[model samples]
Target: MEAEKKVIIVRFSGELSIKPDAEKYQAIERLCKQISLRLSEKNVFIDITHFHDRFQIKVSEQEVQSVCAVLDRSFGVGNYSLVDFQCSSKEEQILRLVPNYQDQFSGAEFRVRVKRSGQHSYSSMDLEKKAGAILGKTAKVNLSFPQKVLHIEVINEEAFLYSEKRKGPGGLPPHKRERALVLMSGGFDSAVAAWMLMKRGVCVDYLFCNMGGKSTERQTLQIAKVLSDLWNPDPIAKFISLDFTDSIEDIKKHSSLTYRQILLKCKMYEAASNVSKILGCYAIVTGEALGQVSSQSLQNLRAIDLSTRVSVLRPCIGMDKQEIIKKAYEIGTGVLSAKVLELCGITQGKAVRKANPSKTDEYLQSLDQSLIEKAIQERTEILLKDVDGKMLQSEYLFVDEISEGYEVIDCRTQKEFSQWHYAGARNLSLRELLANLKSLNKKKKYVLYCSFGTQTPVAAEIMQQSGFQAYAFKGGIGKLRSLQK
Candidate 1:
C-alpha cells in the first residue's frame, strides 16, 4: 500500500489577522510568495491553498520536514503543523483515526485537543473528551502536561489530525511596511537590529561603509547574505558598499582628537542619508544601543542625528548588549557576526561621551564633502539573494583557523606580542612585513593577525598582489583565543 499523503497547516500571525481585510489578504499573499520562493530555491515545490485563518500545503512525507524548515524561517507565520490524517468531521470518523495514533502514544502521557470553526453536531469540548477516552485505553491522559498532544481541527465538514505544532518567527510579512536602509557593520548589534526591523514588516537594504578594506567588506556581505536568504521575506534587498578610507583620513587630519569618532559617525549618517534619498528609503536604520559605546550615548546619538536629514531608526536602542547578542544567535547571524572585528583605529585618545551638536556639525562641515559624494557615486550595489558562499570565498582574504604548515605572523608591536601571542607565531610589525615581503617564501601560505584585525587585511592584500598566498585571521586576537580554547 502507498504511504498516506501529508499536508502542512500554517496559521497566520495575530498581527496579520488584525489588519484590514484587504491588507490581511495582501499580507497572506506576500507570505505565500515568500514561502514558494524559498522552497523553490531549495528544489521543493508544492501548492498552497489559503483559508480564512490558515494556509494548507499539500506535500509528500519526504517534503514535510524541509517544508517545515522553510516555514520556521518565514516571517508572518505564527505556527504550523504536519497533518497525519484527515477525515469527515463526524465524531465516528475522528474516533476511527484515533486508533491509528495509539501505537505511538502507548506508554506515554497524551492529551486530545480539538479546535472547531464551523457549525457541527458536536462541539470541540465534546470531541476532545471522546478522543481522550479512546486514547486513554493505551496511554495515560494528562490534561495538565502530556508528552504527546493529538490535535484535531474541524473546519466545515473536514477534520485534520496532527501530533504537534511548530512555531514560526511570527510577525507581519516583509514589505508590509516602508523600506529603510540599514547601516550594517556585520557585528552582533547591527545584524540583530536589521532582523528586528525585518520582523516588524519593514523591508531593509544594507549600507556597509568600508572601513577595513576587502576583508571587512567580504565578512559584512557574508553576514548580510545570511539575513537576506534566511530572515528577509523580500528578494529586493540590496547590499550597498562604499569605500570610506579617504573620508576617514580626511576626518583624522582636520577633526579634533576627541571628536574624530563622533565626526566619523556623522559622516556615515550623512552618506546613509544621501543614499537613502536615491533609494527612496524613508528612514535609516542603525544597530546603536543607548550608551553601549561612547559614540552611542544619548547626547552623542542626538548629535549624530543632526547630520542626517533622513529619519534615523534605532530598533535596538533599549536592548542590552547580551540581549542583542542572544537575538543575533537566535536569528542565525551570531556566528558570522562574531567573525567581524571592531574597527576603532580611527579614534584617538578618549572619545567624547557627549559631543556638542555644534562642534560635531562644525567638524563635519570642515571635511571634504566631495569625497563622500564620490564614494556614493562609485558605490557597489548587490542584490543579496544572488550572492553565494563561493562568490564570497573568491576574495580569499580571511581565515577562521590557521591550518598546519601555514606560517603565522603576529602583526602587532614587539611589546604587545611579548605580552601575549599565538603559539608558533612570529612577531613581525606590519611595516617590517611589508619591508621584507620580497624575502618571504612565496611557496608557503602565510596568516597574519593584528590586535584589531584591521591592518592584517591591508597587508595581506598587498602580499596577494605581489604573488604570495596570504590571509588575515578573522576576528583578531579575541576570536583567536576562543578558537584556541
Candidate 2:
C-alpha cells in the first residue's frame, strides 16, 4: 500500500539516551511531556505513537515548521526530521518517495543511507544500492563527502524517508531536574546562564533586584519571561522583583565607590538567599563570567558568594562576552537584551578586584537590616505573558486629564522628539529620567508618554512607587496626536 503521511522522527541526545535503562526511560517520558505542552500552545495537536529508540510524532502537514520551531526550543531533542512520506515494507515503495528528494540532491553530490529493524529479506546494503542507482540519475553519487544524504528507515511493515534533519537544543527536559533561583539581570550573561541551567533540565525562577526603576524591573521581568517561555511551558516561572532602591541608596552612601559594585552583588546574593529560603530552592544561578569585570574577580566573587550558603551556579564563568552574546542571539534573547536601557547609577566608580572578606562583612553589618527586610516585604511578582493579551492593571491618565495640572514627559528619543512633540512637552527618555531621578520635581504631577504606549505604564508605576504623582498617557503619543488633530 502506498500512502503519503506527515510524520516526524525524534532522536534523543546521546547524553540522555545513553543513560541506564530506567533513567533513559524517565528522561524520554519527561521529553514527551514537554513536547506536548509546548506544541499545544500553537493549537497544533501532536500524536506520539511510541518511544523506544526514536519517537514517532504525527501532525498535520501544515504544522511542520511550527513543530520544528517548538522542537528547537525543547531541551532533550538531539535531532529531528519531518518524514517525506510513509509506505509499506517494499523496495518499490522507496522509489515513490525518490522524486521528492530531487530538488535537494539535483545539483549536489549525494549518498543514500538505509537502516532497518525487525524482519527484512533484503539487507540494508541491498536497499541502499537499489535506491542509490535510481537517485544517482538525478545527481552525482558520492559515497563519501556528499553534499546531501537521503535517509531511509524500515521498521516492521513500515518505512519512512526524509532528506533533511535539524538539530535541537540538546539537553535534558526542563523541570526534569531540580529548580534554582536565578539572579536575572536582563543582560547577556545571566540570561544565557539561566538558559544554560534550563538546557540541563533545571527549572529556573527569576529574582530581579530593581536597581534603576520600573523600566529596569519591566526589562528584567520581560527578560525572565523570555527565558521562561523558552525553557518551560507549564508551571509558569515566577519573576520576583525586589525594590532595591533603598538598598542601592544605602550601599551608595556607606560603601566606598571602589567597593560599591561588589557590595551590590553581595546584597543581591543575600536577598536571593532569603528569597531562596521562602521558595525552597537551595541553588542560585548568576551570569558572572570569571574576571569579566572587577566585581567578578576571584576574590570579589568569593566575598559575594559568602553572602549566601546555597550553591551558586555560574555556567558562563569561563566564557567570554562574545560567546555569551552569540548564545543569547541563538536562543532568542539577544534582541530584547539589546533593547534594555542601561540605567546609570548602580555602580558609580571603578570596582576593586581584590575585596577583603572582613571589610565586606563590616559593610554588610553597617547596613540597616530594616531597610533590607522592607525591600523584601515590598517585593512584586509579575506573571509573564504577551502584553496585549494580558491586562497589566496599570493606572492611566486619559486625554482630557493631560491639560489639567500634569507635566508631560515625552519618553521618546531625541530624534523622535525633534520631529514633532506635544506642546510644552519636556523630553526625558527612560534612561535620562532614571539617571536624573533626584533632580525631578516630585511636587508636580507627571504623565509619561512613549511611542507605542506599552512602556509608559511601567514607568508611571515606578514613579508612583517612589511617591510621585504619575500616570501613563492613555494610548501613548499615538492616541494623543489623534485627539489633537
Predictions in order: lDDT: 0.84, 0.78
Question: How many clashes in each candidate?
Answer: 0, 0
| Root-mean-square deviation per candidate | 11.2, 10.5
- Tens-digit lDDT string for candidate 1 (111-220): 99898888999888999999999899999999899999999999888899999788889987887358999999888999998998888888998999998988889889
Model 2, span 71-129: residue lDDT tens: 87788899998887789888788777777777678878999999898898899999888
Give per-model TM-scores.
0.79, 0.78
Model 1 vs. true fold: TM: 0.79
Model 2 score (lDDT): 0.78
Worst 10 residues of 1 by lDDT: 386-395
The numbered model that scores best in lDDT is 1
